[model samples]
Target: MLIIPAENAINWKRPPWVTLGLMMACVMVFLFYQGADDRKLDAAIEQYLDGNLLALEAPAYEDYLQREIRFEGDQQSVLELQEFQALREQDEQGWQAVTLLFDRDYYQYLQDNRDLIWSVAERNQWSEQRGAIEEQWISRMSAFQLGLVPSDLSLYTLITYQFLHGGWGHIIGNLLFLFLLGFTVERALGPGKFLVAYLVCGALSGLVFTGFSMGSQIPLVGASGSISGLMGMYVAIYGLQKIRFFYFLGVYFNYFRAPAIAMLPVWLGKEIYDYWFAGATGIAYMAHAGGLLAGAALVWLLGKSWLQVKEEFFEPEPEQQDEQFTRGYAQAMASVGRMEFDLARRQFEALRENYPDRTVLLEHLYQLAKLRPDLPEYRDLARTLMADAMNRRQPEQMLDVWNEYLSKGEAHHPLAVEDHNRVLFTSLKNHDLKAAEKAFERMRLKAEPDMVQEACRLLLAEFEKLQMEPKARHYRQLLRG
Candidate 1:
């Protein structure tokens, strides 16, 4: 089954810088650094084929296979060798010849018996040609130079290999997965911690691949393992909380809501099953599984105390509510167009009752409230608008509503302490220091000590950054108090 999280609305308040950086790193490494990979590989292959290494090795491989009868996949090797022999007799080396390099066991066997089989001069010449080709390949190809090779694994390869990819399809597919899940994960984890988590998961994936494919010389590359880790963290972060997931089984596909953590078993089962039965299809299912486990465990062990989850990231899915309300919303707007103010207000108020958090409704209602500001309900409507307007647009202007509601006249404020806190912090986060300063001053007298202190520190830091010494000094004095 193919399963993935149904997307939540993106919070662009904090752009996923780490995610974009990673995607760009992979792309640049591929386009500029790895551009020579194809040409270098072709040159190495051509050198090997032209030097008659395959022809020289085929007979020796057949002989070795005849004697070494018990090894796994040796029978396939025998068939492959016979095919190579037949092709050689017809004066063609064929693509099978190049692939023989992947069968390291056979390649090693040929090395071990080279002296016994080939005449000394021919063997020495072939060995020299092979050594040159190997050097050319390892030096010129980014995959070989940087990729994670289990047999010759290094601390360096564990990280660099993640940025290397096999081809356009490979990089494109990996990057697509990165963008699909990376942005949300990065925001949930925060940029610095998210970057750390990504590297940790990626390194763990490389280690896992090395554990399973131990002693194989083939280089492992691509970002799938890490991206898989992200998938794990994504599901784990939302553990036990139910969210929509898109699942596909053969011809059937649909979305269903289930506890987020429930996906762990299903995902683990799929990857493990593929590893067991897929017969070395070249995809690293083991690494994917490892990344999934690593991310889940890391996040779980850290928990909220260490890696505090932004609960807002997993808020109730708004699309469903919006979809259901579409008709009523249109009708309400139509009423407004015909000057049916009372009808429109009732319709919007009804919709507001169902979706109090929707900004569009609150924004529209705020405008309507301004039309009847003398009414007591207008104050309540304005308060609600300031509350929801924090993330979407300029919340600074909403402070006008707060300023209008009281005898305080932007001096001591009139909002409930909680709304006051929201307005202060949101303005600070959005960098409207003027709006934030008003909110902060209003809140300092009315808000909790901790909120006041945090708001004070945040405002002080921003003013300091902008080199507003007087403003910074005033906030700093408030912080000391």
Candidate 2:
């Protein structure tokens, strides 16, 4: 008989509803941030133009102005001067004239403000001090924000700073990381905890970006900071386990196992290497570092309970425990086969306690009980074994044992229905009316209709021989029914 393992029967499966809800929520948030970014671009154009710096760099400003003024327009020229001007004057009167003028004078605006865009901090001492102080306050306030730094820390900057992409390649890289790592972390930690972790990582990444690039006017953005944290948590929790990754490095699509603990260190090292030696043009390595740190710390804080939850919900069955029990039972049976009654009895008793439903174990127990029949304990053991057999729909087993006991004429034998009925039938068949009458009285108490009728017919015939006509008529009526 092939026994199916219980663990396989009850597979560890997660409910899809929770995952579905989280995915929907993340999509909605992404759309919201995208919308907010469009608004920030519009606001930045207006700020730049109102500052009267548009005239000197009018040609570049004009080019930025004509790109798009609405949400449906192309965001590819988001940083272009003409598009920026159009976005700024979108709600103003004579937007077409403003767009036309800015497009024409875009080159002049670039020439004038090229210095401001590149070195805004060095040119304006006040702006530098204010920006530095503002960033510092935001970083310090992070301890209280729990991950949500207020927008006033930087105007029109934080909006693009959160989602802006350095290039197509950079955005795609971050997106891939987010999709894979985010899904697993979200599923394991649940949406609420996952959200908290993401936000906190982002906040910390922002602080790191500010600290490392103090005077740089370059705006930071992308989900990389938060996604890095997820990677850290993944490594921490599944360090020993193999993670199947589909690598697309040029042509070869090979599968490999990354040692779980080593994943984070390797990732951090690459980010650091890129930051220092590879020109800080496309990616935010500092943000990745900050996010990784936050992710690792969060996991450390919640790792124990999370592990317990995973084990309780997803652990395989205790096959080892079952195997141990099977081994012990086999040894007990071997003892019984050798007629080591006492040792076999003890083992079988322990096995019965542990695995009460094993019918074969009870059968061996019955044999041991029979071997020590003179002991009062054996009599009780026999009753228990017979009752267990009956419960399991093995009445024939019980009947055999009862008949064996009766044949031995053991005074200590417990009265059983099968043995009682067997003796009653034998006495009645011999035509000893008085003995038959006594047996009939006892059997009538427990016998079904057919047995009662047969007994009554025999008794009636015997009573007729004794010339008891009234009793004979009564018993004949019972047989007719």
Candidate 3:
């Protein structure tokens, strides 16, 4: 079956370095070290086969003795033996020569006197082939020394074995699970604690396998135990939040969303059943179960503070509301384009309460504000837009908002003093002395000393052009101040 997790809600301010580092380490070890070992094993096997061929071609009395005993166990062997006897009757000297050399169990004789046999074999040039075969078997067995064997438990193997995978399929499967679930749990417990949890859980898994698989000598490897621990930690941290999972059962494939905590029993139970009741498939299912239990218990013991951290990461799926907003926004724009103002305004008003942060809704509201400044939503949108304009340094947009809303007392106050200078200069350029006077007064209230002096000089020039000496003298005094 296939199961995959969708994106989680946790937004890290930076990349999850610990998870990325672990992934890089695994890839490096597999590519450089474990891959070289595989090539060595293949070469050793080929050498063993070559040596065995040489041994087969070199006929010894030992071969006849072994074949004679093997012949008693099978009908084909018995027929071959009968043919040999017929050859003996036809050639007495040849038969006597064979019998003299193969009268006893030469295998036992070789075991009792290997030195004596090797001396005779060396004279016949067969000793070098035997030595090559033995060397090949020793070289082929060396890779297993890196893995953790229950019968020969060591602290180094417990940790090292998890990083050594048996094959590409094994490494790929374990790393896939690690990437899917490791980042989420890391975000939940933080990077430092996540590292601790991973190593400790892996160690616990190795211990469980050692205890149950007692006398077995087969070595265990791979990161399944650690990855399964992260899976358990994910359940504990997410609590009741529903997470979407992709699944496949042979011919059938489907997806389902369920609470993270809900899958714990099903996952742990499956591991337990497979470990105890199912036929052996060379998988250490009990170790996976132990890791899960250890991880879950560790998180639970971290108390309410960690539980609250989990709650902080809970973000419900936004798919439904986001779709609704999309459709509503399109329909509202359509109504406006059709010149149906009332319907558009109503649609925009409803959208305002629920999705005020949406850019399109705010824009539509700004349009309505331009036509009907009396509406409260229009004024609210004006303030939002004015602030946004100020942030973006869009002076013309701010001037538009000030004239359409703030100057008309539609919006209460100037968002910034630098904005008023633009308005005053604009009004003076338009020859609207009355509007210029109003903006100058507003500017004096909040303008900086240097800015106020600059505005006073402009007013002095405009007033002097109208031939108003008293007002020009008043501006001269203001500039001097």
Q: Pick the candidate with the highest TM-score.
A: 1
lDDT (0-100) at residue 203 of candidate 3?
83
Ranking by lDDT: 1, 3, 2
Instruction: Summarize candidate 3's per-residue lDDT along 1-481 as a digit string, tens digits.
Output: 6555554643455566777777777888788777676556455446534444223322444354446567654343355445555655675433433332222233234445555545665534444653464355432443355677786788987777778787788888888788878878776667887887888878888888888888565677888888877877778776687877768889998779999778888889989989866654668898899888877776777736543344434433366568888888899889989989889989998987877666567667788766765556566677677666666666567567767776554354334575567668767777776667777887788788888888888989999999999989989998876
RMSD of candidate 1 to the truth, in angstroms, is 13.1
Candidate 1, 217: how far from true, in Å? 0.8
The models' CA-based lDDT, in order, is 0.79, 0.57, 0.69
TM-score of 3: 0.61
| Cα lDDT of model 1 by residue, 227-328, tens digit | 988998999888888988888899999999999999898898999999887754779999999999988988898867767777666544456666768988
TM values, all candidates: 0.65, 0.44, 0.61
RMSD of each: 13.1, 13.9, 10.9
What is the alpha-carbon lDDT of model 2 when measured against the actual structure? 0.57
User: Candidate 2's error at 287, in angstroms?
Assistant: 0.7
Which candidate comes out best when scored by lDDT?
A: 1
Model 2 — which ten-residue stretch has the worst lDDT?
1-10
Of 1 and 3, which scores higher on lDDT? 1
Candidate 2, 377-474: lDDT as tens digits: 65665666656756766655655554565444356654555445655555555554555565566567777878887778877877888899988988
**Off by more than 4 A, model 3:** 1-20, 36-145, 183-194, 303-384, 406-437, 442-474, 477-481
User: Candidate 1, which segments miss by more than 4 Å at Cα?
Assistant: 9-15, 63-69, 73-94, 316-481
